[model samples]
Target: MMLRIPLNLGLLLLLCAGGATALAPAEATGAPCGGLWARCLESKCCATPELTCYEKDHRYAQCRPTGNCRPGFHHEDPVQTPWSCVVLTSPAPAPGPGPAPPPAAPAPPAPAPAPAPAPAPGPAPAPAPPPPPQQCVDKGQHCVDWAMAGECEKNAAYMHEFCMKSCNLCGNLFTNSEEGTAAAPAAAGDGSSNHAAGSSNAIDSSLRGGR
Candidate 1:
């Protein structure tokens, strides 16, 4: 069983227990209390004697000087804690007891976390093929025509390397003998361009066209 106490009686008992007066009811009726400068023990009331109960803490309070206290001085004003200044009179007997409080309700469980989403679908990129090697070959009859017509000026980067004999870019590939100069251009040019679809014409005719 639990001990239940009424608010007013509880307050009177609390005040009396702290060093204040004994009669909460009489104090409520505005009765005069002990002389000024007296501790608020039996006479909970301080009357109008220019004094109030100077409370030190929750468990201590006494009648201290009031009005006429010099302003701006900390010690002048005696009232301390914001707790009640008026102590109660006699204690009121409380009822025996009541049923013990019901057992506390248990707390609810926490919620579960949400699941993460799956990754997006797709194929990964493939690696790039390597570049072909640079080889010397005029490529075709067009190299000579392109050189003569100044196609070398418009497409100099390609024309200069491949058409070196006809465009006169690289020094002579064959000896300066008349036969070497005469025979080299036609043979090398015809043998290679069809050998590869790319710029270098690096592959041999045997592998490309089964010649």
Candidate 2:
């Protein structure tokens, strides 16, 4: 019994030293959990003895010590006298691609050509010139000179008279003096010859004097 008491005292002293280290203040010894900085706790009951309450603003925060908050968090009054579990914000998402280009503008339509001008109206044709007068011709007398002088063409009767005068083959030729005056003296004593001479002499004198 005396030897067992000394060995048990040594073991009890070693166990007390380990318990003091394991239960040390969380701020002085960092976190009790290995390497893990702080825990994400929702409930007020933290499993680890070293994990105490912490906060930022008035909400619950991580299980870190006072004044030791994660990035994006500022130390605030503790809702649970030490700390609480409350998330400030989550991470933002990323961006996307882009939009497509617009379609090309349609080409403008061609302009229509101007309509052709209407043809001008033509002047009415002048009335046809009147026909010239027809010339008159001699019958069978062939009076070309009279026709050329415009006399025969002017009057056909004048042409006939002119043709007759120029030919002189027609009408009375000898006077009554040459017919019976000289021959009447030879038979003047006879009653028939004397009457005939008197009639011839009267006719001859009247013709000579143009009476």
Candidate 3:
């Protein structure tokens, strides 16, 4: 029988040979490296070691330990890990738009007009004064007799003289005298002989008989 080493040892030898082959530096082909083992470093594809990878179109390359692969990159090693990369960039503008215009201000309300002043009241009417006393011409130039007694007597006397002077105009002098005579008798008392006798008696009593 031919002598046979264990199949596991043979497989290990084959794997070590494959690893050596994979680690060998290759000429840059400028061709896209395909499959999970590929990564782009500095715009080129480089055969990375197990679990090491880098971002595409980046300036730098990164190498990680075994079982650490970049995120979003497939790996045949069954390792899930996080990767950091440069974010895309955009240029800042020269001058930004100016600040928005301020909102319009509300208009102020109009002031109320002043009320008109009330009119002033008119002046009160003046009280009327009492009339002056009547004057008598005959009394004096300035004399005004309020009692009128002297004025009345003078008026009666003047009327009498006026009637006497114009007797023809007056016409009833006899009738006036007759009324006066009747009034005198009533004043004197009828024929009092007692009064005359009393007077004689007084005279006789006053005298003594002649010798």
Ranking by lDDT: 1, 2, 3
Write the residue-wise lDDT of candidate 1 on 77-154 in tens digits: 365334444333322233557999999998887777777778887787776777774455687778876765566678
Which residues of candidate 3, in runs, are more than 4 Å off? 1-103, 120-123, 128-131, 134-211
Clashing pairs in 1: 21-44, 22-89, 22-90, 23-88, 23-89, 23-90, 24-89
lDDT of 3 by residue, 1-211 (tens): 2335567778889999998777643433443432243444522333333333444234433433334434564454344443453322111223668999999898888889999899888888887887884332233331222112233245656533433222211334323475554443343333345566888998887785531
Candidate 2: worst-modelled 10 consecutive residues by lDDT: 166-175
For residues 1-211, write the lDDT of model 2, one tens digit per residue: 9899999999999999998877755543443332123433333333344444443445334455433444442346333254233432221223455677788899898889989999898999999999974333334455544443445446756665655332221234312453443333233336556677999999999999995
> TM-scores for all candidates?
0.20, 0.20, 0.19
Clash totals for all candidate models: 7, 8, 0
lDDT score of residue 51 within candidate 1: 59
Roughly what TM-score does model 2 have, to 2 decimal places?
A: 0.20
Which candidate do you rate higher for TM-score, 1 or 3?
1
Index of the highest-lDDT prediction = 1
lDDT of 3: 0.43
